[model samples]
Target: MEETAGDHQACRERPAASHLSWAGDGPETRSGLALGHHRPGETPMSHHLRTLAVVGSACAISATLLSSAASAAPGSPGPARVDAAGDATALKRPAWTRLRAEHSKKCVEIPGWSKRQGVRADQWSCVKQANMQWALWLVQAPGAGGVRHHIYAIQNRNSGLCLTVDAKRNGSSVTQRQCRNKKYGDNYTKQLFWYTPDNRFFSQYAKGKCLDIAGASKRNRALTTVWKCSYAKNQRFKNIK
Candidate 1:
């Protein structure tokens, strides 16, 4: 009972009844209202209503698509991308600088022109010595909740030793120590310092303490230490490039 080739050709050639109704002969069809159903004497108000309905539907569809696109877009802000080699933000990377005491106008230096660790840091004349210059690097502290907190390590350009606190207690002397590039934990915690908007280096380990010139001394070779931050001139420092 297999159908012949001619029978198959005839079946393919025959159109379905639904297709015939869509050929401008019916009142309405699946595609839309048949053109033949619209009388020549149709009211102009009805035509305007139909046109408005189509425009409103298109507007609604466009609004929904725009809303979906906006909802699916990325929301979180991107991380700040700064060039390390450029002069964008100097504190964001390690840069050579001269630390000038606000009260004494002297630059920070290592004693006896030594680059060795355990040497006390002092303020001396603004000389062009390599030991007087520091390479400051900012390490981003952890637990930053949408706010940036930095720990700065100032290393002597001559000896490569980092400026550190002799002890973690208050009134500790600031000295040069072996550079410990740590962001957190017990190592180098006392050495980490944070710079404030008022141009003072605040000690991270010693709460409420800042890098201060001893006795507000204006004499050469005056020692630097950590004292209670009082917004005084002795506690302020300027990073001279």
Candidate 2:
């Protein structure tokens, strides 16, 4: 049977809730230190000086606390402050790589290294070709341990277009299109994907859907498509070389 993007629509029930949009837990708002009220005998100049003195004292205290926190020995007790961007940065996939299907050993590529949009990506014999290399760029950052994993935009090295799905359901057209933002709202997540935490090689572009090879065929030029997210061999892929 010929393979197309819109092939396997309902492999399993899609989760009732999924975190498609993502963002970090940004820095907390802090209030400035308050100086005491005016004294009965205080002149304007004296009050100014007193205010400066209070500020200086507060700065010194802050400095001391900072020094202590910085110098705290290994295995210290207090909870270390967590940066909101840390989790997003940890999942960064900046390096370009050639994704090879686990079952066929062929790399995903844009046919003929075409630079046109709407070109369906396919699998070909692994090679040092420009179209085969892809980069997973973090498009949306997930909150610290938040639900919906971080989203990445997969771009073809040669065409520079992003991998986008025609629809959210399985077997929708998986083609290279101009990178679009999620805010644009016309089925925006068609281009957004995230690596499965349980399986390092599985990439899901939509809820319950993942990138897959048609019939796991070893033949060159085998079309790639989206299928229900699973542990299936055809759905698994890894970096070439």
Cα shift from native, residue 109, model 2 (Å)? 0.4
* Per-residue C-alpha lDDT of model 1 across residues 1-241, encoded as one tens digit per residue: 3334454454446442222222456665565645334436766566555545544554456556656766777532111222211222234445578989888899889978786668889899888778898865665554554535655767777776778877666568998766553433444666678887778998877888899889999998888999988988989999897
Give lDDT for model 1.
0.68
**What root-mean-square deviation over C-alphas does model 1 reach?**
18.3
Model 2 lDDT, residue 185, Cα: 59
Q: How does each model score on lDDT? A: 0.68, 0.63
Residue pairs in candidate 1 whose N, alpha carbon or C atoms collide under 3 angstroms = none
For candidate 2, which ten residues in a row score worst on lDDT? 76-85
RMSD of each: 18.3, 20.3
Report the lDDT tens digits of candidate 2 across residue range 32-67.
322344446767677667666554554456555556
Query: Local error of candidate 1 at 103, Å?
Result: 0.8
Model 2 clash tally, residue pairs: 5
